[model samples]
Target: MKDRLLERLPGTRTATDEVRGAAAPVGLVPRVSGFYQEWITEMKKVTWPGRKDTLSSTAVVIVVVLIIVAFLGLVDFALGRITQSILSF
Candidate 1:
């Protein structure tokens, strides 16, 4: 399985060596370009979320944040009232 996976990888050591032997030594520009090309290739394989999934995830985050904020605000208010009563007495 790992051998098959390695074979699927872009520019594995043996492939890189063959290409390097045929061409000029890889310079910084080629290296950077190769990195970006590989990155784009890998990105293409990614399973990105659909628009509906993204929207639902965002909505869930917003709802949770609002709930936490409300709870904190209520706690602060209660603490403030208790402090005031204690100080007055």
Candidate 2:
């Protein structure tokens, strides 16, 4: 995998070579820039969610969280009441 990735970068050495006492990192700048270049290329291919889809997904998440919070609040109140009743004896 490292070799294949290095092949894509055209001119940089694998970081393994640097660890193995290869000379100065002569290709650091090119390597970093190439990584970002690949990032932009891949990002351009993404199917980003539209505004409506994003809003609907966020609403679902909020509703689920609220339901869970309410459920947990009831459970906590029940436990507190049980504990108080036991201690008051």
Best by TM-score: 2
**Residue 59 deviation, candidate 1, in Å?**
1.5
lDDT per residue (tens digit) for residues 1-89 in model 2: 97687667956767676799835435989778878998999999999999999999999999999999999999999999999999999
Off by over 4 Å in 2: 1-26
lDDT of 1 by residue, 1-89 (tens): 99878877787665556766756437999888888998999999999999999999999999999999999999999999999999998
Shift of residue 89 alpha carbon in model 2, Å? 1.8
- Give the clashing pairs for model 2: none
Every model: Cα RMSD to truth: 8.9, 9.0
lDDT of 1 at 52: 100
TM-score of each: 0.56, 0.65
The segments of candidate 1 whose C-alpha lies over 4 angstroms from its true place after superposition are 1-31
Error of 1 at 16 (Å): 19
